[model samples]
Target: MKALQLSAPKQWEQIEIDEPSPPGPGEALVRIHRVGVCGTDLGGYLGKFPFFSYPRIPGHELGVEVVAVGEGVENVKVGDRCSVEPYINCQKCYSCERGLTNCCESHQTLGVMCDGGLTEKMILPARKLHPANNLSYEQSALVETLAIGCHAIDRAHVTEKDTVLVIGSGPIGLSAIEFARVAGARVIVADLSQTRLDFVTEKMGMTDTIQFDGSEADIEKLEAMTDGRRADVVVDATGNHHSMRRAMEMAAFGGRVVYVGITQQDLQFPHAPFLHRRELTILASRNALTGDFARIIQLIESGVIDTDPWITHHAKFEEVIESFPAWTDPESGVVKAVIHIS
Candidate 1:
């Protein structure tokens, strides 16, 4: 077997390793087909991700095929095409006990908390594989990223009467825009990049955009786009502290704000007036649930959600170590980079 390991920050090596035995009980052995490079992977590559550990096989968004199943495996069978759910949760935790597995008290996400599917084969919990018979290997790889946005929109409960504002035009932000539109909301996107803004308008068919200029009037610009009332639902996917704070100011009175993006710094905001007066409903949308994964697969399979444009760059598994740094550069116009594994 061959695997790419991140020995340290800005370091990666391809090494030969022994193949594992058959899957254990409740597990499935999968032949990895494709992996999606996300912001988390990028952060890890730069030694910036807070939760990462070095000498790790950094890949989580996987498109795979079941090669064999363990004694207790039930949901998947050999040769089934699937998407791997990387968030391995402690089913006994308080959150998992209440069906909030995405926020499990002891969650170990692959690629971040443990070795992930960066290699040719990996063993994952059988329950974590979602069948994707209708999607291509490339499309199957996108389910995880798209599910994040699905979970965010579900948290906001957006509808046609709502004006939804999505901050940042990165892959995660673009996913939010796709689901918000599916939820019947008039979507408005804000980003610092003109190219991304153009994609939002031209490809996504979004009519509204606010190119943030770091001016106090940015909020006013957002309000003007919503007929001076601001947005009914604001989903911040920038992960940038400043943009996260501004999301609070761009939401309408009695509106909902879902933070899908995360930051390491403490998030602080005014209490007496800003959050209190507006009667804001702020929420943090974490990783997606099994239902979200299933829904995204169906949406893509039905042709209701076209994610073809999301693949802006591609590289073979062997070429990843050399090509990865370039994707981190914004000027590369990288939307979503996919790695062909098998």
Candidate 2:
């Protein structure tokens, strides 16, 4: 088996290894089919994503098939195409006992904390799977990414009547916009690039965009977009500390702000202005639950999720190590890159 491994930051190489053995007692051997390159993966590549370890296979957005099932694996079996949950939690933890395993005290994600599905085969715990009915490899790989947005929306509790402002036009931000739209919030997205804004407008029918770098009246611009009242909910998808700080300044009075982005530096914000005015600020980590994954699959299968515009590029597994680096460069317009393993 050949795996694309990130030995160090800015260094990804393809190394040949023997095919993994059969599944263990509670594990299943997934024949990895599709791997989605997300901002999370890009962050890991650039040495920015937290909780990442080197010499890792950084692909958790998986589209898989059960080539072999473990001894007691009854939920899925051979020939079953599936999407992985990626979240590994300590089932005995207090949070897990309360059915809120997203905050599991001993939780570790596949790509972030352990070997992930960047190779031809991966031995995964059977519990970390959601059945993929008829979805293609590329589409199946997207479920996990979309689920992140779903989980964020769940945390924000976005409603139909709210006016939403989303910062960043990256894949996660776009996914956030989609979920917000489905939740019935009128959304306006801000980004530094017009090309990316055009992508949202032309392909996704989102006409509202704020040019972040071009305008000095950015706060005023966002204020105008929300009819001078500012946004009811503000989400920062740009992991940059500056962008997140700016997002705090852009929220409406008594509005909610969800920080889906993460950075190493401690976040800075004005003290009295942030809290005294009654802003509900939240940090939305990677906490997509099984319910969100199920909902995303339903939305995609039901035609509610238009994934046609989401998938921008695809390459064979053999080309992964070569093409992965290019996807990190924004000028390449790699909105969503998929690696086909089979």
Candidate 3:
């Protein structure tokens, strides 16, 4: 089987690897159909993702078909098309025991901490696969990316009455905006790129957007959008420390702030007075739960969340080495890039 591996930063090699063994108990052999390239993959390519290691098969967002399933694997069967939950958590961990499997004490995320489904076929725990028979391969592959935002919205408890501000217009940020809208919250998006801001407004039908540059004018615009009260919930998906810090200032009194983006850099916030005065709640959202995957799949199947305009770029498995670098460039205008493996 051929697999794409990141030998090192800025270096990609298509290598031939031995075929994976057949499914064991509680396992399923899946044929990879589509793979979604996300921020983690881009960061791993540039050696920027802290948890990523070199010589890895980098793909987590997957659409796959069940080729075979071991005994007792009733959740999926032969020929079932599914979206994979790539967060491999230890079920015995404290968080997992409490149903917070997204943040297991020791988590091994596919494509980051371990090899993922960027190849022809791979064996996964059957429980990690969520059957999405109604969705296309491209739509099924994007469910994981959407799940990140779905979980973040769940953490913040966003409601119809709340005004939500999503920072960053990247895939993760866009995912947050989608679920926030589904929750019936008034959505406001902020991004440094005018191009991206325009994308959310035009393509995503978001009317309230601000070209943010850490300026007071940006805050003024946000306040104006919220009738001078500021956003009731702020979801920071930029993963930039500056933007994460500014999220504190973007929220209204008694607001909740969810950090969906991860950064290795140490973050420092000096707004103790403001935090205490406003009684703010700070939350760190990690990966998505199985329920999130189920909900997002249903949303896509029901036409509540459109996947038509999300995929802005595409490449075959063989062209990944040549096409990946270009996708990393912001000028390429890639909202979501899917790698076709079959």
Q: Highest TM-score, which number? A: 3
Candidate achieving the largest lDDT? 3
Predicted structure 1: clash tally: 0
- Please give each candidate's TM-score: 0.98, 0.96, 0.99
Order of candidate numbers by lDDT, starting with the best: 3, 1, 2
C-alpha-based local distance difference test score of model 3 = 0.94
Clashing residue pairs, backbone N/CA/C < 3 A, model 1: none
Per-residue CA lDDT of model 3 for 149-237, tens digit only, reads 99999999999999999999999999999999999999999999999998998899999899997889989999877889998999999
RMSD of each: 1.0, 1.5, 0.8
Write model 1 residue lDDT over 1-342, tens digit each, in one string: 999989998899998878978899999999999999999999999987878998899899999999999997889999999988899998998899999999899999999989988899988899999999888989989999999999999999999999999999898999999999899889989998888999878888888898988788888888677778989899999888888887888888999999999888778888767689999999999999988998899999889999878998999988998899999999998999999998
Give the runs in model 3 whose Cα sits over 4 Å from its true position: none
Give candidate 1's TM-score. Answer: 0.98
How does model 2 score by TM-score? 0.96
Better of 1 and 3 by TM-score: 3
Worst 10 residues of 1 by lDDT: 265-274
User: Which pairs of residues clash in candidate 3, taking residues 3 or more apart in a chain or in different chains?
Assistant: none
